[model samples]
Target: MAAILTSLRNTVIAGFVLSLVLILMFLNWGGTLDYNFCAFLVRWLHVISGVMWIGLLWYFNFVQIPNMPSIPDDQKPAVSKVIAPAALFWFRWGAMSTIVFGIILAWQNGYLLDAYTLGAAEGFSVHKNIAIGIGMWLGTIMWFNVWFVIWPNQKIALGIVDAPADAKPKAGRTAMLFSRVNTMLSVPMLFAMVSAQNIY
Candidate 1:
């Protein structure tokens, strides 16, 4: 247990092993392999990816960005050149995985079009679909910002890509603003998603 806990890869593998044991137990107890079970698994994956993406997003806003100014200028490179890049890699991929799994979950549950259309297929009468649709749209917009806007500007800002020195500040500002935008949207997005599952 100590060895596994000391290594992230091993810890994650152990977690999956535990999940597999749970599934085997369920099957042994007479749970059937079915479409609903498959859909549940997709949703579980979506949630995991979302936690990674949004958790990192919040970490940047709530911790790193705010604390950066206090750090000595000389030591700043440790964060910029090392930590930031590693975190961003996981952040962007987490966003990608979240969106992909979310879309797949929606499709598996047979609400892809209805949710995307905000229940227009049902004349917007289904509150559940409408709620999820709003969350989905918000998530999509956030994902787009992460990939197309934030990542590109961040690359320039972080000096991963070459740009005139003057442009770096501007690029950094742009990325920060969009990241803030996503943070602002995150609360309502989570509300809408949970509402779809529980309230609506």
Candidate 2:
């Protein structure tokens, strides 16, 4: 138990194992369970990934980035050399996983085309599709920012890339700005997605 709790891989495996246990305990396989169950599972995974992604985003904004100036230069390497890079790995993957699961969930729920097309698909409620579409588009943009704008710049800022000395500061600023852009989008994106429950 302690080993599983302490090891991330083990912990994640345990979580999935528990989820399976719960599903088996409650759901009537092949009789009561159907596509809805799969949709729920994917939605659950999507929410988990989104939480990891946004939690780290907020941590960077509300904690790490803001507190960086106060950390002494000597202690900075702990954050820069070790912490930030590790966080970024999960951050980028979280974004990818969230988007992938989100799309799968939408498809499972039978509104993928409607949402993607901004309510143009027949039989889907325009309002609901618009709401979910807004969220999806916002999330997509955030994912793009994470992979392209932020990660590339962060590589330079963290000295992972061979960048000119004068380029580091600019790269850091670009990453921060794009991160802020995602942060700003998060609120509306969340509202759109959540509010869709009632709308649909």
Candidate 3:
């Protein structure tokens, strides 16, 4: 138990194994679950990944950034060299997984085209798709910022890339600004995602 607990990979595997066992016990077997049930499962995964991504995003914005100045200068390497990189690894991948699973869930639900096109597709009501569409667009923009803007800048800022000494602060600021942009959008994105179910 201690050995498994000490290893993250083992821990995650154990979790999956436990979940599978629970499914076997609690859920009907023998292909009893259908397409909609599978889609619902995918949606659950998407939501889990999204929560990880946005939770990390908020942690960086609300905790790490503001507290950076207060940490002793000599001890700051613990954060920059170790913690930030680790967090960013999970952060970026969480974003990627969230988008991937979200798209898959959308496709399974048969509204992929409609949501992507913001209800421009035939047979989709504007009211139903609009809310989810806005959420999708916001999520896409946030994903873009995470991959293209924030991660690149963070590489320089965190010294993952060979950046000029004078450029580090600039890179850090750029990353921060984009992260803030995502933070601002998160509220509306969450609203749209939730309202889509109840609104129409």
Candidate 4:
């Protein structure tokens, strides 16, 4: 038990197994599995992943980065080596998962392109279309940074790949700056996403 709990991989596997069991139980207890059900599952995945991504974004902005300079050099390694990497593992993957599920949801509903374009008149009511379009654009930009800019630099910063000593700090700063930019965009992104559903 102690050994199992100590290994992060084993712990995650165990947790997933337990959750699968519970979900199976729910299905047995009259949860109708259908397209809508599948869509609901995907949406749930999107929500969960979005929370993790944004949560880490806030953690970086609100807590970790601000405190970094004050942390003793020896102690900083624990954060950079263990904590930040772990958080980022979830962060990048969460961003990917959110985008995947969101796309799936839109596609399944037969509005993928329309929503992307803000539901241009022929396809949807004007207001709702525009609102969804704004959210899609924000999500796209966030996704772009997550994959193109942030991940590459983080690889260097975390020393996941070999990098010149001087290059590492530069990479780290670049990643951090883009992450802050994402944080700023997230405010409006979330607002437009939620407001679209009801307001328009």
Candidate that scores best on TM-score: 1
lDDT of 4 by residue, 147-181 (tens): 99998999999898999989999999999999999
Judged by TM-score relative to the true structure, which candidate is superior, 1 or 3? 1
Model 3, which residues run further than 4 Å from truth? 29-31, 122-124
Task: Estimate, for each residue in 1-200, the C-alpha lDDT of model 3 and write its tens digit.
Answer: 99999999999999889978866765655544677668878988899899889999999999999999999999999999999999999999999999999899888888788998889865556776878888999999999999999999999999999989899999999999999999999999999988988877
What TM-score fits each model? 0.97, 0.92, 0.91, 0.83
Compared with the true structure, the alpha-carbon lDDT of candidate 4 equals: 0.87
lDDT of 1 at 115: 94
Q: Give stretches of model 4 more than 4 Å off.
A: 1-31, 121-125
RMSD of each: 0.9, 2.1, 2.0, 3.0
Candidate 1 yields a Cα-based lDDT of 0.96
Off-target runs (Cα >4 Å) in candidate 2 are 28-33, 121-125
Clashing pairs in 1: none
Instruction: Order candidates by lDDT, high to low.
Output: 1, 2, 3, 4
lDDT of each: 0.96, 0.92, 0.91, 0.87
| Tens-digit per-residue lDDT, 51-127, candidate 2 | 99999999999899999999999999999999999999999999999999999999888888889888976544578
Error of 4 at 103 (Å): 0.3
User: Which candidate has the top score in lDDT?
Assistant: 1
